[model samples]
Each structure stands twice: as C-alpha cells, then as structure tokens.
Target: MLTLDDFTPVTLEDRAFFLDLYARYPQQHSDMSFVTMMCWNHYAHYAYARVGDGVVIMSVIEGEKTFRGPIGPRDPAALEEVLDLAVREGCAAPYYVFDEETLDWVKALYPGLAFRSDRDFADYVYLASDLDDLPGKKYLTIRGHLNRFRRSCEPVVEEMHAEDLAEVREFLKKWCAWRHCDESPVLAEEKEAVLYAMDHFSDLGLSGLMIRVNGAIAAISVYDDLNPDTALIHFEKGLPDCEGVYKAVNQEAARLLAPDRTYINRESDVGVPGLREAKLRYHPHHMAEVYVAEKTDLEKRHQGRGEI
Candidate 1:
C-alpha cells in the first residue's frame, strides 16, 4: 500500500509526473497546483497523491502557512491517508479546495468537513482579466475611479524600492489597527506573508507599484506570478487621505502586468460579510474553492461542525 513516507521532494521529474496527471484530467487545475507553492516555500511541508506506482505531495511549513495535498485519484482511502499524514506532521487543519469529485471523497473520509459556498478563504477580493478588454461596466467603473483620482490630486505611480519599506510598514500598521480584536486568522497570516514578500521581493518573484501624492506615499500594491498564466495580487493598502486611491492603484496594476496572463488570483475571502459583498461585486471570472481537513483523531477535538 502507498504510504506518506514514500512522498518525495518536488523535482523536475515530479513536475513532469504531475503535469502528465494534470493533462489527463483537464478539469483539474493542477497548474495552480499546491506542489508549486510547496517548492517555493522550500520543501519543509508537502502534499502527496498516490498515482500509478508512486505517491505525490508538497512540503514547506513556514510560520503558519502551508499547503497539504491536492492529492489525486480521489479514492476515499487515499484521501484519508493524505489527511492523516497532514495532521501527523503538525500542520493545523491542512486544507485545499478542489473539484466536487475530490471534495466528495474527502467528505466521505472525514465526514465532518464543512464547506463554504464561496471559492475564496479570506477577507479580500481579486480583480482580473486584461484591463482593456474588461467588460464595459467594469471598464467604466475603473475609468471613473481613475478620472476622479486624476481630478482629486496629482497621483504618481512608480516601481517600489527597498527604501520605501519603512514607510510602507508604518502605513500597514495603521491600516491593520482598524480591525477588531476578534479578527480572522487567515488575514493575519496573509499580512505576515505580505511582509515577507516585501522584504524579499525579487527573490519571492514579486514586484510592486506605489502611488505617491504630494511627495508622500498614498497606496502600495504588490503581486507575483502564481504561474505562467496567473498573476496574483498579494496585497494593496491605501492611506485614509485618498478618496479613490485603492481603485486607481489596482487599475494601474492591471495595465502594467498585461498582454500575457490569462487570469489573476486575488487569494481568498474567509466569508467576512463585507469582503464577500465586495468580491462578488468584481464578478470574479470564477473562484477556486478552498477547504480544511483534519485527521479523524484530531477531528474529535473540534465540535465537528467543520468550520474555519
């Protein structure tokens, strides 16, 4: 029987293996595959799948962030094994959002797995697609914001520099303080990840844009390629002074990173009410559903409601 120990570091050979499995199942989006995220996080935690003669998984448990398995061959037994390994490794509620087939098998294995109807897992909205060909209504909204911003103040957009980190950190500290004491865990981790990305921008495959008004930074945005076809907007923050700074920064980001990518991954929305409303407003091309799974033993610890 295939076991977790058999799982190995994702190498060129493994990418070829996963790519082949992915091509065979075109409905699966292994292209934004968790394995890639594992590799980037440096092989500390991994997700695995049992396929043919081998098992596949990803690793790299940095701080509180992790991706377990989007393991394939959606058999209930195989899914359980993946979850078991995830818990044994000390990952807290390792999760993934996959096709109904995968989710069904997972639900069968854990029985307590609860699913949020939305595709995102945190309190953020993502806007994607080429800025030019964006639907008329969306295009108009963006244009309207930019026009208003143009008239509101002298806005300058420029590539971010390492020197700006101190000011950016200060601005973000103030922005985060607006949240309540009982805020979301995902949001907190995302903030930490964004800070890490900023400190090591080039190494993290990140690039950013900052908006300055009257010689002071007003808004800053950062994004990176999730894959060859998907660019992910990781973080964006605006000063309270600007009326339309957030909208203008996003519009500018789309303009600058275009002509080659098919989509953008704005990450997740943890079902925060206002965030859900905003993401829905973008009319996301579609959402990638995410989920949390626990070992049956660990499952006994919670009330088994299977939430967050």
Candidate 2:
C-alpha cells in the first residue's frame, strides 16, 4: 500500500510534471496548485506518490496530517490505497476534499464516510471582470478609494522583470518590518514562501505586475493561470505608502490576467476576520468549499447532517 515513505518531496524539479497533470484535471482550488505545494513546502511539508495514471499529494500542516488529492483522474483502487494510508497514519480527517463534486465522488465510491465542511480553507472565487471593473453601488467605496489613490499618487502597473527581483526583495523587507513578520512564526513562514516563489518566478511560470507610485515601487502581485478559465494570485503585497494600494494592485492584476480567463481565485482567508471581510466586500461568484473526510460510516454521517 502507499505510504509517506513511498512519496517524494515536491520541488521545482517536478514543476513540468505536476503542471501538466493539473492542466489535464483542472483544479478549482489554489491551495492544491503545484506552485503552492512547492513554495510552501517548508511549512506544509508536501509529499506525493504516483497512483495509477494520476498522483496523490499529502501534507502535514499544523500537526495534522492531511491528503489533498489523487489529482489527475479518479482511480478508485488508488484512492482506497491512499485513504488506507491516511488512516494508518492516524489522520483525524485525512481527505481534503476541494469541492462538493469531489466529496460526491468519494461518497459514491465509499458509500459511508464522514465529511465536514472546512470553512477556514474554502477558496474565494470571483469573476475576473468584477475585480477589474469594480462596478455598481456596492463597490462605490472601493472605487472611491481607488480614485483617491490615483489622485494622490500616479500609479503605474508594469510587468515585473527579472532585474526587478532586487527591488521586490527590498520591498518585502520593508513590508515585513512594518508587519512585524519576524516575531510571528506564521508571518515569517509566509515571507519565506513568498520569496521562494519570487526567486523561481520563471521556473514556476509566474506573471505579475509591480505597482509603482510616483516612480517608486509601492506594491507588487505574483500570479499565474491556475486553470484554463481561472487565474490565481498567489501573493500580493505593498507597504503603507498609501491606503487602498492593495485594492489597486488587485484590480490591475485582474485587468491584466482576465482577458482570456473567466475567473480569478484569491485563495482562502483562513479564519482571519479582517481578511474574510475584505474578500467578502468584493463579492465572490462562489466559494470553492473544502471538506474534510474521516473514516466512518458515510450513510450515518450524512443522515446526521441531513443529507448535506
């Protein structure tokens, strides 16, 4: 059976393989992206093993071991094997079901499993146009803020270049200092992850915009197309050079990436109150709800939850 020992660490070297596999399957959540697995591997400790024609990814996060996928195509036997490994590892909730569709598939196969919604990690999905346009009365405040930002500082959103790496690093240092990232483990790890993504921008297939105000770099966004119809913004950061700068970079990134894509996934808020409010303000087209499944009688669990 599959086990952690059978898996290998996810790294830059496996980018092409993972991206190709994900392209065929088309993931809805950004957390399952290869870029995410590699960049945050230090904190998330991602590992994977080939399962039939597809692959299975697993990670141990916050002292809990979890499984994200048998990512390419559905293989019942392979999935069963992975699930067994999860239980053997004593994972309280092993499966990290990305959406309802995945949960449905798993349930149809297993017939009796306990699954619970994981609101903390559900991805906020938005129409690419909504972010670019900021239309209607609801967005009036955001639009006004964007306008005020433009009036005070002539902002230019330009394609980030290789030579711009130094400036981006400098900007991150200042940004971290302001946020006191060094004092907190979570922020410190995030800083490390962001730097890794930036450092390997080309290999990671990243496209981003650097927002400059009055000829000085004020904000930057790093992103890539997550699927044929969705683009994912992995990291967006800025100093308090001006309020609403984050919103400006966000809008610009959407405007630039939205031409061919229909949606943009800004990822999860992770139970952060301020973050949840900010993302909610934009009005998501949908939230790709995540669920955690543990080994149990599925029918009983579903009955208790009223067929949810």
Candidate 3:
C-alpha cells in the first residue's frame, strides 16, 4: 500500500535519518549519498518513503519520476512492493539498481525482465593509491602534466577551511564565467548544486582542498566519505588561468584521502564525451555500474503472471 503520498521530500532535517540508514546499508554509488540528495534536491526533486527496515528513494527530473531500489537490508518482499509502486506511478525507466547483489535478486524475481545499462550514470571508482602515487607507465601522461603544472605554477596546496568559503565562492564565479555556465542549462544547474554544497559544507560534513596560485584560489575539490572504504568527490572546479590546475587539485585530494580510504569515486561523466575521456585516462579500478528497469519490461513481467 505504499503510495506517492507516503513519500516525503528530502530536506536538511532528514540528513541524520539518511546517514543512519546509509551507515547500515553502505551505498556504493555517489547518487545514494545524503549530501548529493540534499545539494541536488532542487533539480532532482528527491523524496523517500520508509518501508519496513528500508527506504525507497524517488526522484522527479524534467517531470518524469524514477525510483531507486530500497537502501537497507535485503528484503525481497519490500523490494517487490517498491517495484510494484514504481510500475504503477513512475516513468519509462522507473527503477534503478546500483549494486550487483540487488541486480541479481531483481533478475531472479523476474527472469524475463530487461535492465538497461546506464553508462552515463555509472560511477568511475579508482584506487586511491593509483591516483595518489601515479606510479606506473599508465600514468605517465598525467605525471608529465602534473610536473609541467608544478614547474609553471608552483601551486601551493592547502586544505579548505571555513574562512575560505568566501574566496571559494569568488573562484566559482570566475570558473563559471570561464565555462560559460550561464549559457548552458546543465552547467547552470551544476553551479547551483556546488554552491549549495559550499554554503552547507560543515552541515554536510564535507572536507576539501584548494590549490592556490600566487596566493589566489585557482582550484578546489570538495569530498566526503561515501563508505568505510571510499571517498566521493562531490565537486571539483578549477580556473583555466593555470594549465593542469584541475589535475593538481585532483591529485592533492587523492593524496590526502589515500591514507584512510581505499578508493576515490570521481562520480559519473553524465555522457559528456570529453569528461568521459578524461576520467577514462585515470583508469578506473572499476565502475560502480547503474542499471534501470524499463516500465514496459516491468509491465510485461506482471502481464505474464496476469497480475497487472
């Protein structure tokens, strides 16, 4: 009997509830993180419904509603109920599966159901050591770029502090101008999302690093623990004034996090060709794959059992 009415909008007040659930469930994807949900809530219109020991998340984007599988202990009955609700109320690609274990169970439930691989949303996860050290021939190009940047810029790296928020904001304005964020709807949304994160940095439990060139902030990376073994970079921005500033911020962040975390999730490329190529160059340890079940596929499965 779970319905849209049972779902509540994601807000700052719900952070603790989500953190608790996520601690117990341990999510693999960045999208499942509470900070991501809150920061992008305006654009995604996120909501959740608590069912039994689990919570089912739903997001409305561009007027289309899509649901993610429950984030709690594996309970087949609870999952089926959510799936039924998604079929009745959600868009074409109604349900998303983030991990392989859930995908396996969902496939078992409906042997004929088809799940589409969402390459655009797949998270690129890299070994912390690989990014921190740049030790092998595979990283020769990146090492060369870093060396060139260091020789040219002599960047001073520092951990971002509370007082740095104002300067960070100014840096973002400059970055937006360089990227022409105002001209692109997607970039504008991203600007808003990152600003929201910075505004609530402490509240969201975020840590970051800034690369300073000539005592001015040129690049910044905001991140937080996604799980015991992984750190997720929520926002990484750099000014084009310094070549390879982006790589500098990225490497510094990885070096800072590598000691404690095993992996660094740079998040998804959102199907951007250039961004995808850039992430692929890092050589991900593995992709935290995302899969979605189409409404037609779910309907067909239900129809086969005369249950729809």
Candidate 4:
C-alpha cells in the first residue's frame, strides 16, 4: 500500500522520475510540471506520489484547495485508494485535470463524483513541425495576429532574464489591478509564486518571449515543455494597446520550439465566459476534461459549495 511518505518530493532524482512518469502517462503531460513549478516557486506544499515502483503523481496542497495531476495509474482500485490518501493528506478537495479517457475511467470507478465541467480555460493546441506550412481556418486568426503584431510593434522575442523579473512583476501588478477592478480576489500568494517562477523560469521548462516596441517591454509570454512532444503556456500578458504582441510571441514560440516539440497545451479557462471565447478563437483541436473525485458525499457537497 502507498503510504503518506510516498507523497514527498524527496530529491531531484525523485522529482525527475515523477516528471518522466507524468509525461508518458498518455493523458498527463508537462502541465504537471508547470503546476508543480508554480507550487514550488511559491513554496506551496507540493510533492510527488510514488504509486508503485514505476508510477509517480504530482500534487499541490494550497490551504483548503488541493490540486492533483496526471492521474498516472490505470488501475481503478489503486487510483481510488490514492485519491482518498491525497484528499486526506492534502487537507483539501482533490482534483485531477486530465484528458477525457482518464476522466471516463475515474467516473466509472467513482460514479457519484462531480466536476465543475468547464471548457473556457486555455486548451492545448498542437502545431506541425514545418512552421512554413501553417494550417487553414483554425489558425487563420493566429496568423492574422502575427501579421498585425508586425505592423504595430517591432516585436522582439527572447528568453527571460533575471533582470526581466522586475518588469514582469510590475506588469503583473498592473494586470492584477485591472483584474481586481472586476472584484477578482487578487491572491498575493499566486503573484509571489509567479515571481518565483520567473526567478528559475528557464530551469522550469519555461521559454519567455518578450515583445518590445522602441526597446520597451510591451508584451511577454512564458511557456514550457509539458511533455517530450507538447509545450504548455503558463502566463501571457500584453498591453491592450499593443496590436499583435501576443500573436508575435506565439509565432516566435512555434519557431523556437519547432526543433524540440510539436504541440502546445494552453490549459483550461475555469469556465469564464470571456476567457472561453478567447480560447475558442484560437481553435483548439480538442479539450481535455478534468474532474474531482471523492469517496464521501460530504466532500462532493463541499465541491459544489466552492463553486457557488
């Protein structure tokens, strides 16, 4: 039986092992690393789960909310036990963000569990190795953005530096200020974590693309490898005035990552109407569904309460 001790991120070797397992899990990808990096960057209680000699899981414990990823194992009984342990040790509701196949398996095992059922968040998109041969319809808007970005700003995409942290932090503060204008709960912890990610940004599978106009940082995007074949974007921000800055960053990223991988996992939108619209505009091939699993009816009720 997997014990609580199996959940700690003991060493780099252990971390790498989990990273590898998560990547190969068919459904879970490098996004787990992104989530884990966010937790570690913020010093939030994050760890890995050793389900067996070969299986490793990533988990994050944040106050009353616990997020789990890459549901690695295929055994329903084993996963059920792990879910129970995760919720207990995590001291929060356990959640798994994964593809539809894994979701189907878990739902079959735990018939009564509930999910917020959302598609509005950032979704994963894949690209062809040949950047020159861009696809039709789906990528029309993306191409347009890149074209417009060139007209509006002399865009410059580059790896992030320690010096960029100050600018990124300032950008976030401004962005958060705008977010707060809409009564969004601006979590200081999340900002702290993002800054932390910036500090070790490169080491954490991140490629920062900065767009400059007249030598000033106007837009920036941070993305990293979610798997050997997929990249996941974490945070991307641009000044509203900047015409094609966001698209410029994406095209440049496709160029940079062409040699390394073929897919991009932008992640979910948390059911926000506007965010969903923006993601859909990008035209994702398909969205992976994520769900929360629980053994007790009380925990299910708690999940609904949080949504309310």
Candidate 5:
C-alpha cells in the first residue's frame, strides 16, 4: 500500500527519473513537467512515490490534496493499491489527468468511473510563432501595445546570466514588496516559489529573458522545455514603471523558445477572470484539458435514491 512516507519532495536530481518516464509517455501539460513541479514545490508541495514499476505523484496545498500518475505504463493492481490507500488517507479525489492520453487511459481502465473537466485548470497552449512574430490582424492590439511602449521607452532584451541574478533577486523583492507578498498566503507562497526557481535556474535546465527600459530591469520571464515539441513558461513578472513590458517580455521569451519548440504553454489561469482575458488575447491554438476522476463507490447516495 502507498503511504505518505513513500512520497518524497521533488528536487533537481529527479530530472533524470522524470525525463526517462516522460520520454516513454510524452506530455504537454504544465503541471506534468518536472520544471513546474520543482519550482512550484513551495506552493503546491509536490511529491512522488514509486509504486512498483510506475510512479504516483501528488500535490498538496493547505490541507487539501490531489494525485496524478502511476505514470510509466498502466498497472491495474498498482492503481488500485495507491488509489485505495489515497482514499483511506482522505484524498477526496485521487486522480487529476491533465491530457487526453491519460484521460483515455483512465476511461479504458475503468469504464464506469466519472471524469469531470475543469476549465479553470486547462493550460492555454499556443503556437510559438504566433507569440514570437505577433502576426496577422488578430495580433493588432498586441502589436499596438508593443509599438506604443517602444515609442515611450527603449526596450532591451537580454538573456539572463548567473551574474545578473543578484539584481534580479532584488527586483523580485521589490516586485513582491509592492504586492505585499508577505500579507497574503497565496502571494507569499508564490513569492517563495518564484525565488526558488531563480535560485535553481541552471540546475533545472532553464533559461530566462530580462527586459530593461532605461537600463533598469522592467520585466523577466522564465521557461523550460516541457516535451519534445512544447515549452512551458513557469513564471513571468513585470513592474509598473514599464507600461507594456509584460507584452514585450512575453514575445521575446517566445522568440527564444521557438527556435526548437513548436508550442508554448503559458499554463493555467486559475479561474482569475482578468488573467483569463489576458491569456485568451494571445489566441491559444488549443487547451491542455484537465480532468478529475472519482470512483463510483465514492459518489454520495441518498437514502431513497441511487445518486444524490
């Protein structure tokens, strides 16, 4: 049986383990990538347990928890063991499949199970070329934003280096201080997560871009290859001094990532309306769908009815 003790925190060394698994089962979802797991471990508290020949991954925040994987290949007995243990341990939902491949596998494994889609967690995936070039009339507004910013201030895009990270750290402190990161639980966790990524940037096989206006860092974005064809942006932060620096940094990051990656995954909106609107403006080629699974036996039943 799988227990909490079996799960260990995701770290930089787990890259090889995940990479081998991912090569066998390629995925594009942001959360499935090792880079996302390691960087956001402070926020999500990701951990993994080896279950026979497969692996079981879990994420916890506050006291609530969710699970994914047994990622290698399907093992009916293994899934049954881990999930049953998870239910006994108070995981209301034991599975979150972030792509259609995993969803279909689950459906085939348990035809009677219920799978619920959550748009709030669906990752917005776009063509790297679209973001890099901002082509066509559809991108007119984005182009306008960049043009106005260019007219107002000169924007310089530089590849982030080890030497530049100290000032970048200071910039992040300034950014978080402005948002009062210490006062809000969510922001505080995110602040810590962002700093962790900065500290382990190279160890995680990551690259970043910094946008400077008038010789001051205005915005920064970090990204990593999620799979053979997809690149995922783990974090992007900007300051008020540069009005359109967000747009500028995003495009530049896409340009850097697009040379070898075909798709750019900007990750989930977390049901934030303003963020949803902003990401939608980029015109995602498709969404990396997410589904929550529940065993039929776990569904609530009324005294006189089959389901309630």
Candidate 6:
C-alpha cells in the first residue's frame, strides 16, 4: 500500500528521474511538467512516490493535501493504490486526473465513481500556426494590436540569455510594482514562482524571448518544451507602458516556437476573470481538461472495497 512516507519532496535531484518517466508517458497538462512542479515547489509543495512503472504526485497548498492519479503505464493496481491512499489520508478531493486518458482509465475501473471538471484549471492549448500567423477574420483584432505595437514601439525581439537574468529581474520588479503583487497573496506567490524559475533558468532548461522597446525591456516570455509537439509558456509579463506590448510578446513567443512545436499551452487561468478573458481572446484550439474526484463520492462507492 502507498503511504505518505513513501512520498518525497520534489527537488532538482529528481529531474532526470521525472524526465525519464515523462518521456515514456508524455503528459498533456502543464502541471505535470517537471519544470513547472520544481519552479512552483515553494507554493505547491509537490512530492511524489514511485509505484511500479508509474509515480503518484501529491501537493499541499495552505495545509490542504491533494493527490494526482499515477503518471505512467496503464496499471490498474497502481491506480487502486493511489485511490486507496487518497481515501485513507482523507484528502478532500480523492485525486485529480489531468488528462483524458487517465480520466477514462479511472472511469473504467469504477464505473459508478463521479468526477468533477475544474474549468478554472483547464489549460488552454493553441495551434502554434494560429498564434504565429494570426490568420482569418477571427484574428483581425489581434493582428491590428500587434501591428500597432510594432509601428509605435518598433520593438526588437531577442532571445533571453544567462547575462540577461539581472535585467530580467529588474523588469520583474517593475512589473510586480505595477501589478501590486504585494497586495495580493496569489500574486505574491506567483512572483516567488517566477523568481525561482529565473534563478534556476539554466538548470531548468528554460528558453525565453524578450521584447525591447526603445532600448528597455517592455515585455518577456519564458517557455520550454512540454512534449514532443507542444511548448509550454510558463511565465509572461508586460508593462503597461506600451499599449500592446503583451500582444507583441505573445506573437513573438509563438513565432519562436511554431516552427518546431505544433501547440503552445498557456496553462490555466486559475479562475481569474481578466486572465481568462485575455487567454480566450487568443482562441484556443482546445483545452487540456482536468477533472477531480471528491472524497465523498469516492467514499460512497469504494469505502468498503478493502483493496481499492
């Protein structure tokens, strides 16, 4: 049986182990990515337990513990162990399913079990071409914004380097000030996560692009490959000094990734209304959906099933 003791905190040392497992399983959601977990470790408190050919991930946020379905080969035994552990530990949400395949597998095992979709956590995935080309009438408004920003700012797009980390940190300070990150707990946590990523930029194998408007960095985007055909943009920030600097950075990041990747995952909106609106304006190709099983629902069906 899987126990809390079997789980260990996620750290840089486990990078190779996770990369190997992820290479075999290939995750669809940004949260499953090793870099995302490592960078946000301070906020999410990620830990994992290896189970057979798979691994079970758990996170503690504000003292609330949650577990995710095992990520690896399709092994019913592994799934049962995670479910049992979640139930025994009394996690409010028994466990989470981040990909459709895992959801289906869980449903197959317990046909009576109920799962709830978390719209706030659903990742917006876009065709790399759509973002890069801004084609058709759907993108007309975005194209106008991008064109106007280019005309007004004459922004120069450059790839981020190790030497640029200091400048990037300064830019982030200005951005945090503009956004009043200190006023909100969530934004403060995000600021910490971003800074952690920047601090370990090279160690995390991250690549990014920066937009310089009149010799000063106005916007920046950091991204890395999530899978063979998908690139995940982990952090993006733009100062309001430029009217459309955000749009410019968005398109520039797409242009940099489109040639090699088929899709770009901008991650979840976390129920932020303004953030959701901005992401939707890009017109996602599809959402990499997420679902969770409530403890009550799990207890109802599997309470007495000693093994499950």
- Measured on C-alpha atoms, candidate 5 has an lDDT of 0.84
* TM-score quality measure for candidate 2: 0.94
Please, what is the whole-model Cα lDDT of each candidate in the order they appear?
A: 0.58, 0.85, 0.92, 0.59, 0.84, 0.91
- The most accurate candidate by lDDT is 3
Q: Quote each prediction's TM-score.
A: 0.63, 0.94, 0.97, 0.72, 0.92, 0.97
Error of 5 at 10 (Å): 2.3
Q: What is the per-residue lDDT of model 6 for residues 232-265, given as tens digits with 9 covering 90 to 100?
A: 9999999999899989999999999999999999
lDDT of 1 at 9: 53
Model 1 gets an lDDT of: 0.58
- Candidate 3 Cα errors over 4 Å, as ranges: 303-308
Candidate 1 per-residue lDDT, tens place, 57-170, comes to 544556443344444454444544555555565456454545566667556655655654434453232345544345677567766767888788889988877777777777
Q: How well does candidate 4 score on lDDT at residue 196?
A: 64
Q: What is the lDDT of residue 14 in candidate 3?
A: 92
Model 2's C-alpha root-mean-square deviation from the true structure amounts to 3.2
Task: Give the alpha carbon lDDT tens digit for every residue of 129-242 in model 3.
Answer: 999999889999999999999999999999998999999999999999999999999999999999999899999999999999999999999999999999999999998888
Cα miss at 254, model 2 (Å)?
Answer: 1.0
TM-score between model 3 and native: 0.97
**Candidate 5 displacement at residue 36 in angstroms:** 1.8
Q: Show the colliding residue pairs in model 6.
A: none
Model 6 error, position 261 (Å): 0.5
Candidate 2 local Cα displacement, residue 259, angstroms: 0.9
Across residues 202-300, which tens digit of lDDT does each residue of candidate 2 receive?
888888889998788899999988889999999999989888899999999999987888999999999999999999999999998888876553213
What does candidate 5's lDDT look like per residue over 148-236, in tens digits? Answer: 99889888889998888898999999899888999998789889888988898888888898998889888999888888899989999
Tens-digit per-residue lDDT, 1-308, candidate 4: 65667666534345455556666664443335644445343444555565543344554434543545435557655664566665565444456545667667656655656666544433556552433234777677677777776876666666677678788778777766655633534345555656666766655556676767777677776776666677677777777667767666666666767777766666677676776776666666556555554435425533533322
Clashes of each: 16, 2, 0, 8, 0, 0
